[model samples]
Target: MPVWTLYGIRRGIATTSWPEKEGPTQPGVLGLPHYHADRCQDNCRACADVCLPGALSFESCEAEERLALDYGKCIGCQLCTEACPNDALTKSNDWAFGVRNRDDLIWTEALQSPPAEEVTRKIQKYFGRSLHVRHVDAGSCNGCESELQALNNPYYNLHRLGIFFTPSPRFADLLLVTGPVTYAMQGPLRETYNAMPEPRWVMAMGACAVSGGASGGGYSCGHGVEEFLPVDIYVPGCPPNPAAMIHALLLLLNRASQHVQGGQVAH
Candidate 1:
């Protein structure tokens, strides 16, 4: 037998059984910063100041400045954790932040789920176990693309889950969008969405796709695809890892349960 073949044999199956079981891909990598609003000090905007994407912001209330943390705009840069002198914003491993609703990504917000049976029936009827995705680059920095490419690798092997990425939108059940929708790509993005059949879903695949990331509200960048397209899923990261993406996609198909609500991860 060839040496590589022998090595493979010794390794057994290289693919991990994740989403189905406890197959962790990235071990200790930091995810979005976890915010403890009660721990936050008065007049402290340190975390907000260091935030590049404005994930951490101040909301003025009745003679009070409440720190608002929006996971949709978080890029997982860890700068806020570093800048926080009050330990209000801290690093965490809570990367699997896929949600069915957009408001669930906001801090201190409440989230409610639809009837599971209704959702399950609808998903099983259209997608079942097999999901065909079409990725559209409105205007990405390609960080998300790099992580997305890892899905088909030997470790992750997204195909085993019956999820696939199709080049043509006509055959896709989900339109996975990345980046802040640029002015030039807006027309093409709309055209692609129009091609997909009814009952189609859209997944905001990154911080840019969810809420425009670092470049949002800036020159040459729109807020996100959600401004125009109806997003069914929101996966926020500078570039969500393959594991996180897998969770989000499955969450969309109702094959998995959403863990994050009101910007808090369920244990």
Candidate 2:
């Protein structure tokens, strides 16, 4: 027998059983910020002031002034948490964040964000049992790329779930984008999206791709992938882990139901 085959046999199955069963949890994985409005001072804007990506902002509503946290724009820098004098924003360990709608990422004190939209059977009808993804790094820092690469590794074994990453956009069913969509990559990104076969979908896989991350609002970088591309799913994190990315993809394919709401894991 081949040495590689022997090693594979010794390792057994390394794929994670998740969504259907509990799997290993990553240590030190950061998640969305938990908000406690009651803990906030009446006139405080400390957290908003320190937020690098403008994820936290004090907005004026008809009824009253409120703070809004756009999870799609958050990079999990924890600066808001650290700047909160009243503990209104705090760190959380729940890293599973994936949503179907762009509006689901925005949260205000008075308005409760609606649950993510369910993937209709139509999507499943086309690419349900199997999915082919084309990943484009517009201008990533390689953090998101590293996580994307991990999905194919033994521990994740993305292929076991019938998902695959392909080099050709012509054969892909999904466009998995990373980075903030820099000006230099805008045209190529669009061309790649255009090259994909029909019944295609796009997923913003990280804070950078979702909302430009830390580089948002820069002159050279686009705000997010959605600004140019019609994004079908949004996964938030500086670099969302493989599990979160998989959850988003599964949701897109109608193979799974959403378990994340307002950055909290419902399951």
Q: How accurate is candidate 2 locally (lDDT)?
A: 0.83
* Stretches > 4 Å off in candidate 2: 110-115, 262-267
Whole-model lDDT for model 1 versus the true structure? 0.85
Each model's total of backbone clashes = 0, 0
Instruction: Give each model a TM-score.
Output: 0.92, 0.91
Task: Output the TM-score of candidate 2.
Answer: 0.91
Q: lDDT per model, in order? A: 0.85, 0.83
The sequence of per-residue lDDT tens digits that candidate 1 reaches over residues 23-77 is 4568898898888777889877888888888888888888887888889999899
Task: Rate residue 7 of model 2 by lDDT.
Answer: 82
